[model samples]
Target: MPIILLLQLSNQTGLLSLGDLLLQAATVLHEGVVQVVGSSSAFAAIKSDGSGIIWGDAAKGGDSSRVEHRLQEGVVQVVGSSSAFAAIKSDGSVFSLVSTACGGDISCFEHQLQEGVVQVVSNYLAFAAVKSDGSVITWGDAAKGGDSSRVEHRLQEGVVQVVGSSSAFAAIKSDGSIIIWGDAAHGGDISRVEHRLQEGVVQVVGSSSAFAAIKSDGSVITWGAPANGGDISRVEHRLRE
Candidate 1:
C-alpha cells in the first residue's frame, strides 16, 4: 500500500495525491521524450526540445504557410493518420497537418490547447492526448476516433498511460488495472480480468485483437482473442512478471 501525505503551505493549499506524487517521480525516472507515429495519413515528430515537424500526404498537410520540404523544430509530440498529422508543442500549442476541413479549418488548428500534454497517441482514424494531470483528450471520427463523447467516464484521474490499436484505445492506471473503449471485441474487457492482474503492471500494448501487459518483474499477461494474441504459454517464461 502507498502512504498518503498532507502538506500545508502559507497562502496556498492543495492536496498532493499520493499517486500524483508518484507519477511525478516516475516522469523523472522515465525521462526520455516520446514520439508516436502511424496515427493519421501523414507522419510527424514531437521532440524533447518542445519542437514538432510534419511531412507526407500533402492533401493532409493543411498548412497554408506554404508547403515546405521540412517542418520547423520545437515540437514536443507528434501523431499521424492515413492522411493527416497532429502535434503538440512545449508551449501548449496544438497544430495539425491535414485537409483544413479535416480538423475544422485554420481557426480550429490554431486554437490554444490545454496545457501539460505529456504524451500524444493516435490510431488510423483519430488522435488522443494524455495530459500530465492524468486526463485524456480525444478527437477524430466519432465512430472511429472523433471526440470520445460517450466513453468519457471510462478515463479518469490516475491514468498513467495509454495505447491505441487500429481502431480502439486502452488506458492503464497506476494501480495496474486497465480500461478500454472502442471496438468492444478488441480487448476492451481486459479490465474485467482484474482478479488475474496483480500489483505492479508497468506497461501495456495493444494489437489488432488483443492486449498485452508487462508486469514490474518483466512478466507479461495477455487477454482477448487467443488467436490474435498468440499462444501465451510458449512465451510466458520470457516475460518478467
Candidate 2:
C-alpha cells in the first residue's frame, strides 16, 4: 500500500505532520491522509497528499468558489495579500481571485485572472508578477501599484526580490545592495547609508513612510522619517557591542 501523511500549517502550531495509526496488533497502519489549515487571515500549505490550498480575504477571492477543486491536486505554492490571493500550480500556471473595482454582481470572468507566472506579490493597491526570466508585470493603479516603465533597468535580469510600501516599491538583487523606486522620501535613495542599509541586508520591508532591512545576522536596520520608521535606537543598541 502507498504511504500516507498529513501536514498542517498554522501560526499557532507551526508545521506539524502525522502518520499512520496503531492497529489492534499495535502495528502502525495509516490509510488516508488529511491536511488542515487553521485560523489565519492568510494561509499557504503544501500537503503530504501532494495537494495545496490558499485561502484568505474573501474580497480577494479567498472563498473556495474562486479556485477549482480539481486544481488543488496540482498546486505547489501560494501567496496572499490584503485584498488578493495568488497560487502557483505544479505546471507553473498562476491563478488569481481578486475583487473588481466595483462591488456586487461581479463575474468570475471579470475577476478571475491567470498567467504563466513564476512568482507573485501583492500590496493593498496592486499585484506584481515576476516571470521566469526575471521580467515583471504589474496591475492596478500605476502610481501605487508600481510603474515598471520607471525602473526598466533594474527589472532587467538581476532582481531577486521585490518589496512594496504604502506608496512605493523596492527591489533587491542577489548582491547585498538594493534598488528603490517611487516616493523618494521613502528611502529610495541608496547614496546615503542608513543604519538598516549599513549592514549587508538580506531582506527588506516597506512601511507607510519608511524602509526596514534585516541583516544576515538577524539584526534589523531602518531608514526614512524617524516617526514612521520606528525608533531604531533600541535595535541599534542590541546590535552594537
Candidate 3:
C-alpha cells in the first residue's frame, strides 16, 4: 500500500489542539487520511483503507460510534449537509449520522440506494443521489430538494451531473439542459430564465438564493431570488467575456 498523507488535519484557528493530538498519534496518522468533510459543527475523514473517522459535535454527526460497524471499511466517499454526514461505500450502499433535520436519516430512500449510486450531493437539509442508471433519488427536507415528485419524470434518467445550493438542486442532463427543484426562492425555479435554459447550458452555479447557467455561447443567465444572486443583468455584458 502507498503512504497517504494529511494536509491541514484540522482548522488552524480553533482546532489546533485536535490537530496536535492527531499529529502526535503518528501511527494512526501514518495509516493515512485521504479525505476530510465537515458540516456546520462536526468533521469526518476517510482513511486510505476505506474507513471513516469522525469528531466534533456528536449531534451533528461527529461521533461515528453508532455506525462504526458499517463505516469500518470499504467506504469511498463522504458528503456533509448543514448538520449531518453520509457515507457511500464501495458497494454503493449508504449510511448516515446525526439528526434527520440535517438529512442524517435517509430511511425514506433506502430501497433506491441499496446499490448502484455513483454520486451524492446535498443542500442545507437534503440529499440527492445519482444512480448508475442515471436516475435520481432524494431525501431529507422536502422544501430543500428532498422531494423530486414535481419533476420525477425529468430526473428518471440521462442526468450527468447534479449541483445543490443551500435550499435547491439543479441537474444538468446529458443534452446540456438543466432541471431544478427545491425552494423557489433559493434556486428551485428557473422559469425567469427558461428561454435561455432551453439548451446549451454547459454549466450551472448557485448562491444562497439563485442559480446562474453558463451557456455554450459564453452567455450567462440567472434566476431565483433577485438579491442573493439572481439578478445579474447589471453585469451581463461583462459576464459574456
lDDT of 2 by residue, 1-241 (tens): 2211212223355533332211211221133223433222434445555565434444444454545563447766555545455556666666654444311112332222344457766555555666666656655445655455677676776566778776556677666666666555655454455434533678999887677777787777666557887448756878542
**What TM-score against the true fold does each predicted structure earn?**
0.63, 0.56, 0.86
Per-residue lDDT over 136-239 for candidate 1, one digit per residue giving the tens place of the 0 to 100 score: 77766645444566667756467788887766677777777666666546555555565656467778887876778777777788876677882387778766
Candidate 3, clashing residue pairs?
none
RMSD of each: 16.3, 10.6, 6.8
Please report, in order, the local distance difference test score of every candidate based on alpha carbons. 0.58, 0.54, 0.83
Top model number, TM-score: 3
lDDT of 3 by residue, 1-241 (tens): 1112223244556745644655754556566799988888877788998887776677776666667778778999999998888889999978787677779878877877889999999888999999888999998899899988999999999998899989999999988889999999898988877777878988988887788888898888888888887998889879885
Q: Positional deviation of 195 in candidate 1, in angstroms?
A: 3.7
Clashes of 2: 1
The pairs that clash in candidate 2 are 196-221
Q: Which is the better candidate, 1 or 3, if ranked by lDDT?
A: 3
Candidate 2's TM-score: 0.56
Candidate number that wins on lDDT, 2 or 3: 3
Model 2, residue 3: distance off in Å is 35
Model 2 deviation from native, Cα RMSD in Å: 10.6
